[model samples]
Target: MNAVSTTSAERVRADLVRARSARSARESLIKGLLFLAALLSVATTTAIVVTLLQQTISFFGEVSPLAYFAGTKWTPLLSGDQQSFGVLPLLWGTFYLTGIGLLVAVPCGLLAAIYLAEFAKPKVRKTVKPILELLAGMPTIIFGYFALTFVTPVILRDVFGIPVSEFNGLAAGLVLGLLVTPTIASVAEDAMRSVPQSLREGAYGLGAGRLQVALRVVFPAALSGIVAALILGASRAIGETVIILIAGGQSPSMSLNPTGSFQSMASFIAATARGDIPQGTLKYETIFVVGFTLFCVTLLLNAVSTRVVSRYRQVYE
Candidate 1:
């Protein structure tokens, strides 16, 4: 009987050890998979950067850096007419569109986030959030069409009584802004929700009014997150292609007017690539150079956002 009892105890111990070993193995597998995924993402980004740099260097070899930077004209097809590929116009157009888009997105998105997070009932929020998310998921080309066919012509002709141009940066930027608002709202709302309940309670304990607590305590605490969200939205606006391609004119004008037609870097690339430019041609390589510029701009924005978020991060007990 003693031997049988000892045997049963040993079996139970063995089973427990085996179960722990299996769990550890599963955890290790999951961690390894995640690590590999992260590594792959980094590798892909690095490859893209390297490829763009290589192509850009080749393009600069054919076209002088001075001409690319200083000259105003951008006639890649005409070699004898003193063609200039000054990137400033394209860069300015990008910023102009991005600024306009952000101007529209930030206020609307932040307000929506405030309502959803602080004011809305659960049922209302549940319905609204999904609908907003659906808007985000809609294809950019669809938004481009909406901007071109519906918004621009209607508003410009009907409201302003002006002949609407086929391409308008303001319309594109506005549509892009609408598209990005949901993303900002979702991020900002999550950030706001992450505020500690203790902070709110403390404000209440001090006899603070609801608006005072929200403005003074909550908003300040969440400012870092809100800034990060805005930065991300800006990044999206900068990288947007389809809406700009359809609504923003192909002309890389240096105009800052919201109503004027302009081309973003992404839109320019899309337009250029659509032409039958031979592979290994100057124009072909220029696309890579533009892409490289776009990538660097977005990277810088992300880095700034990261620094700002870190600097202003709030600590709570």
Candidate 2:
């Protein structure tokens, strides 16, 4: 009996060792796959940057950097008479649309997030969350068409009596705001949800009402993530192409008014390419320069978001 028991114990120990070894091998394979995916993402970004820089350098070779930067007009193709290439107008238009988009999206999205996270019951939240997420999944072109037909004419013209143009920045910005609202709402809600339940309970224990607890405790605690969400939404608004291309006018104007017609950087690229600008010409290369600028702006926003999120990460003992 003693001998038999010893043999069974030895067999069980060997089986445990083999199971641990298999688990370690599986973990190592997962780690390798994750590392490879990260490397591929970096490679893709580097390739795109390199390609844009190469084209922009060739463009600068044809058109002097001073002419490209300081020129007031942007008439790249002028009916065999005169040509100009300035990017300031496009930059201004891009910022104008982006600013308007933020104005509309931020307030609405933040409020929605606050309501859902702090106030809503579980049943209400479950029903509403999916509906909001559905907005994010909808195609951007549908928003563009809505802006062109339903939103622009009806709201801007008949309701407000504002002189609505066919391709106005206001409509584009408003529609873009709607498109980005879901993203901000989802991120901000997640941030609010991450706040410690203990902090909220303490607030309640101190004779604080639900509103006071949410406003004074939860909102402040989640400020960093809220800011991150706003930055991310702004980045998405800035990089948008189809909505701006369809609703924003082809004319790149340096105007601050959302009511005015303008062209964003993405719209400019689409418009310039539509014309007969040769692939190797200065006009064509200018597209890359604009694209590079857009890329840098979004990259900076993402970096700021990363730092903010990292700094505010809650520590546990």
Candidate 3:
């Protein structure tokens, strides 16, 4: 009987050893996979930066950086014409449109976020939030067409009687505002909701009104996130390609007026890349130079967002 019990104990111990070995092997495999994913992401970003730098260097070899940056005209592809590489016109158009878009998006998006976060009932919020986010998923091309067909002709021309061009910055910027509104609303609302319930209750105990509480306590608490949301909206406006390409004309001009047709940096890149500019030409290299400039702008915006968040972020137990 003793011998039989010893043999059974040995068998049980052997089984336990096998299970531990299997678990360790599985854990090691998962760790390897996670490491590989992180490495791949870093590698991809490095490759993009390297490629853009290579082309940008070649571009600057022939064209003066001052001419590329400060020249008022951008007519490199004009046949039999003195080539101009000044990026100011494109920069102006990009920032002008983005400013118009922000004018429309900021107030409207903030109000919507306030309503959803503070006042809306649970049922309404659940139904409305998803529908609002759905607007973001709609194709930008459709928005472009809407601007060209309905906005320019029916609304701007008929109702307002503004002498807007067929493809103007105002319509494109308005449509771009509508496109990014949901993004701002969603992010801002989440930020506001993240404020602790205790703060709201304390404000109520002081006999503060709902509006005062929302604006004073909650808004301040969520300022970091709100600023981040605005920065994100600006980045989206700056990087947009299709809406501007379709609605905003490809004409590069230094016009500050939104009623005029103009070309944004992103739109120029897309329009030029699609055309028959042969590889290795100055015109072709302009694509990368413009792209690098855009990349730097976006990186700066992200850095600002990080700094703002760090400065203003609140911590609660």
Candidate 4:
């Protein structure tokens, strides 16, 4: 009986060892798969950067950097004496639209976030927050149409009596602001909500009013996150292609007039997507230069965000 019991105990031990080994192997396989998935994202980004840089270099060979950067014109396809490719017009147009978009988004979004975070009852929050966020998921093209058909004519024309073209930067920027508002509101609300409740309570204990506690205590604690949210909103506005494309209209000009039709970097890329010139020609290569410029701007924004977060990140107890 003793020998039989020993043999059964050894068999059970062997089965347990095998089970552990199988589990370890499964985990190892999953880790390997996850690493490859991350690597794929890195590889794709590297490929794009390499492709754009190579073409941009080739473009510089055809068109001098001085002419591309300093000149005010952007008519790369213009015949004979009219050809130019200055980048300022595109850059300024992009900035003008993005600036106007931020104006519309930032205050409204921050105010909404403040209400949801500090003031709203759970029932009201539950009802309103999701609907606000739903705006982010709505297709941008729809917003573009709304900008052109309704915004330009009805709001700008009828209410303000402002002169607005069929497709103007002001209309596009306002609509883009509405499109970007959800992103800012969602991120900023999360930031504000993450503030430690103890801080709020302490402020209250010190005889602070609700407004004072919320503004002075909670808002300061969440400043870094709020800044990050604003950065994200700015990036979204800068990269937006479809809304600007449909509503802002593609006529590259160095004008700051909000009511005037202007072309954004995104719209420029979209306008030239058809590769109107033969491959390897100077006209064809202009797209790559523009693309590279956009990429650089995005990279700069991300770098600034990283620096801002690191410099101001709170060390909480």
TM-score of each candidate?
A: 0.86, 0.85, 0.91, 0.90
Model 2 alpha-carbon miss at residue 261, Å: 1.3
Candidates 1 and 4 compared by TM-score, better number: 4
Candidate 1 vs candidate 4, lDDT winner: 4
lDDT of 2 by residue, 246-313 (tens): 88878878866677788888888877777767787667787898888788888898999999889986
Q: Please, what is the whole-model Cα lDDT of each candidate in the order they appear?
A: 0.87, 0.87, 0.91, 0.89
lDDT value, residue 187 of candidate 3: 88
Q: Give lDDT tens digits, candidate 4, residues 33-129.
A: 9999999999999999998999999999878999988989988878888888899989988889989999999999998999999999999999988
Ranking by TM-score: 3, 4, 1, 2
Q: What is the C-alpha lDDT profile of model 1 across 217-258, one tens digit per residue?
A: 787889999999999999999999999999887887876566
Cα-based lDDT at residue 232, candidate 2: 86
The clash numbers for all candidates, in the given order, read 0, 0, 0, 0
Candidates 3 and 4: which is better by lDDT? 3
* Lowest lDDT block of 10, candidate 2: 72-81
Q: Which has the higher TM-score value, candidate number 2 or candidate number 4? A: 4
lDDT of 2: 0.87
Instruction: Write one digit per residue (lDDT tens) for candidate 3, span 1-317.
Output: 99999999999999999999999999999999999999999999999899899999999998999999989999977645578899999898888888888899999899999999999999999998998889868888998899889888999899999999989999999988988899889889999999999999999999999999999999999999999999998999899888888888889888877777989999999999976779999889999999999989899999999999999899877
Error of 2 at 116 (Å): 0.3
User: What residue pairs are clashing in model 2?
Assistant: none
